[model samples]
Target chain A: MMMQRRLTTLFALALLSFVAVASSPPSSRVVADSVYAIPMLTLRDQQGQLFDFASLRGKPRLVGMFYGSCQMACPLEIEYLKHLQRVVAAGSGKSISVLLVSFDPARDDLAMLRKVAGEHHVWPPAFRLARTERGDEGMLAGVLGIAYRQLPGGGFSHNVRVSLLDAQGRIVAATDASGRPAPAFLRSVDEALKNP
Target chain B: MISRQLALIPMLMLPFAGKAADYVPIPAGQFESALAIAGHAAKLRLAAFSMRSEPVTNAEFLVFVRQHPEWQRGQVPSLLAGANYLRQWQRPLEPGESVLPDQPVTQVSWFAARAYCGSEQARLPNWYEWEYVGAADATRADARRDPVRNQDLLSAIEGTSGHLPGVIGTRPANVYGVRDLNRLLWEWTGDYAAMFPNPDARVPGSVANLALCSGSALAFADKNQYALMMRVAALSALRPADTAPRVGFRCVREPKRK
Candidate 1:
């Protein structure tokens, strides 16, 4: 009977240790378990809404990066995303959130962002155009495997990348879809929305 | 006299104090870079800044990890660091026997390096800034014109390719009193990604092909400077979260206004 009581005490001590380990702070929890799960970044959208980027984890998102004054692939990138959005809605019968964060925070202010959105016919609620004040746009670009360089003429040279993030904010798939919708990328978007 | 003597005590203890970082002033100037801007060999006007005299050491990084436990090995998220981040450390907080206390801390991701610099209210130097400072020798600010100096730098790069990096500041300081810019290890720059646009982006898909074809091609102003070209190539190949055995970092700060 005494041995049985000792085992019960040991079990209780083990349980307490487990609880203590599990209750560590959120920072210790490794919130960015995947590239899409990058830590919360506060950004101002075209609509002037201060959005918490981390809060979008529960919903599937189509994410890309662009600039307001980009005269090259950025326009095609927007059109490709718009095409993907329509394809995903038709394929999965669910509208996915599309987010394009600007790399040119110096020029892509609220007025310019709003103008770009209107030109692209991207209205918020389904589409969001955002910019960061703290120069972390480079950090985001790094995470998404996008590379951009500012030219001497105030234009930029950058790669085209569109990533499909799952409901948990982990990248399901990404593609170099410039001017045309990549079939595999559209299928991945449909799959994510269907599962979510 | 007694008060002056007491003041010397604190100054003497300053090196042993917990503050491990030391900054040396780099005067701003117009310098010609090996990389061209806007399809022309334009001189860059660099801002005055202060640079760490040496790379961050293992012992110093240990103190950093202790204070910010989130950056500790195995505790850092995979998204911010690769599997080999701080893999050489003996434990989460210890640098162990394999890693010497004075050796430059390598196998650090760009994200980790940025965070470490952030802790000290500094940032990583841009590629242009790094290239400008790296142009110096022990006597001259611009040593690329000297063939002997160029050969010596090439030999140094070849000699240190396979081996572990030596202790920081073991080599002589440059003209600006900065140490280990070329002799020790390749470094992470703030604008490393901006140096080389991905080749895939130049393909004919959208207007990007026309916009970036000539300006963004892999063209270097001084192609014969193999050491500088190799550094650019090595840095451009890495992602921000990726870590390498031979890559380390130092921090830079804007000069305080008088």
Candidate 2:
């Protein structure tokens, strides 16, 4: 029985090493300070494909949170991001990616994500609207300095603080996405994209 | 071999893992929060939920870190917790001699607090839920109106000032059978930051107002509820990743679907 157990343990070790070898190495070890060091947060985008938040580590991205049913501020947020994208592309000839995760996961399902994306004329890959498929959405919100509270009537009271992450997922700059992107914020985005 | 040892951690933690019934049910009710926006006191409705009777103790959190190593002091990313995260503990896994096992754990960030609660299949109580529970004294629910009781609470908070909080359950549970709701430590409500104390948030078209859609500026319903107001102000001043020497948290669970 002892010998049988030994063989089983040996088999497990071999399998573990094999699996480790099969997985792709991170571009670089995620530093303890980086937000990407957050446990693997799997997000389902508007296209309904599951992608890990860590996958965006090697590039600069604009990250924020919004709810699908938000009548005013959320739509304005999308527009502002699009405007930022256009301005950045026009000036720097580089397109920065965007990720907007939902605050209301119960209501912001696959259909809601898709519907919101369609209405804003935003699409995935370059721009994505997503819901947390697994992991703590509040942790992400907290990291990004976003605060939200659900009101009595099912509406959310939230802030539109969008953060600009460097290639390492360190927040380099942030701005209230309620209006046109601040010039200082635009400068940081330009700077991050250049370094990336 | 390492994996085998790690797998035994659950069994090791069995002794420290308190009963699941540690959570006491808080009945549903409506109450006017001290802080409402635009001088309007919005009567908020709360759903019946279960809450941890006592604040999480240091010994219990030590076991939690042993199981989820990523949440340990040095292992936690800076984005999720401040540099002062778990500073009182001698080591990542040891609360040490200076810290008592049953003493409430403090120096925790909101993110860390949320993650700790999440491990128990629970979440941090919302501000309203917290306030609702905090309203109780030994005999009566909604004891905020009693001048003597409020003075006693204020004294208790001031007494613990400049020192670590004492062990949980030193006093009897309130009417809801929950101990140390707002007495020992300033607990992290899930939506602590959602309370906008800034007057600018009330302005209809201001940048702050725009950022906070459907948001109203918070106003205090009663100036006499100084203790609760102090907590709101202190909590609002902290960033999510920021940790404090006096801040700790407890968990709450929604009722099971029939």
Candidate 3:
């Protein structure tokens, strides 16, 4: 009788362990093709809240890289993105999340991120200005087709590139983010938003 | 006590077991880069750092992937590495017989190179650091002005195409004690894309049209620096995820901050 009782308890334990293993977070099941699979990146947003870059998964969003101290092109990039957000919303009646990561992590502290967010009137849960607190943001930039270099002077020479990613963190489209959004890029964004 | 001392033999041999340990120190200096751009100064003041004497070989990288399986071919994220990442390898964990163990590892993405460097507490050298070291020959630093040496290097580069890269250290070490910087294979710089050569810098709004800041357009300082220009061109053509059979990388270790 005791042996049977022990066997039942062991079987229950095995089933419980199996359930626990199956219920683990989906992070372990990261897709090999997704951008989030390039090692976990921890970031501190404009509001100074620490979050994993991978946590931004499960929602299609726009991503770009900029430095807070950038004078000409970066500010223009912010305005251009704002215009893009407004257009996407007016056409689809749905808001798109935007993440602007800073490539100059040495200078883009929490205060600088918050300042940039305030200067552009962009806020969290919709538009977030974040800096890398732990991992290499250069890897992130490389994946998104953004390039930056610190010039001999205090300023930086960089290209403004923004990417539209699906909920699976796959880049669906990209734009130089210069003047106006390309029609084809807009169409891709629309398709992604619709499916997401 | 004698037996206990004998048991320490394996631990002593561990440090010399891998080929990844030969790093030579490079002195800091203000060097003129060939691809100087407008608005950005051509002269770069670099700090002292240690650079790997030779590029990482296939055998060393295979060991690296074995320890870090996430970086192995077919397991790495496609966004970080392309379809050709380590395609020369026989398998994800094996380099096979055809892929020589001593040959400098090619077909590796920049991300993978950076990761391998990070494992060794180093990173890919910036372009200026690379240029400074590459300007050196066997005896003299800044040998770019030597026409004979330039022609010889140009010939070597021309001979490299459509052929397998030779083993590392085939040539004598440069003045910095570094080998294979200019000849064997093209290498990845930490900021290659930043050196994008806008075709017509004289044209107004061309820099702005590309959305590159600082009004900088890459202009070669010396027109005769064709070898260096070819290196820059090769690096500029590659995306971070893309890899070529002729491109490999060496790592640098910056001085620790106080």
For model 2, the stretches where C-alpha displacement exceeds 4 angstroms are: A1-26, B1-21, B197-218
- Per-residue lDDT over A51-139 for candidate 2, one digit per residue giving the tens place of the 0 to 100 score: 98888888999999999999877888899899999999998999999999998999999999999999988997899999999998888
Please report, as a residue range, the 10-residue window in candidate 3 chain A with the lowest summed lDDT.
A24-33
DockQ, each predicted model:
0.33, 0.31, 0.38
Greater DockQ among 1 and 3 belongs to: 3
lDDT against true structure, model 1: 0.79
Q: How big is the positional error of residue A125 in model 1, measured in Å on the Cα after superposition? A: 1.9
User: Could you tell me the TM-score of candidate 2?
Assistant: 0.86
lDDT of 1 by residue, B1-258 (tens): 999999899755543355658899999898888876644574767889999988887877888889888798988888888998988888888777898877888999988898888889998887778888999989989988888877888888888774568877667899999999987899998777667554346364432232342333355777667788777777766778988888999999999999
Instruction: Give the DockQ of candidate 1.
Output: 0.33
**lDDT of each residue in B90-205, candidate 3, tens digit only:** 88987887777778899999999888888898888988889899999999989988999999988999888645578877789999899999899998888877775343322334
Best-to-worst order by lDDT is 2, 3, 1
The TM-score-based order of candidates, best leading, equals 2, 3, 1
Query: What shift in Å separates residue B43 of candidate 2 from its native position after superposition?
Result: 0.3
Looking at model 1, residue B38 earns an lDDT score of: 48
In order, what lDDT does every prediction score? 0.79, 0.82, 0.82
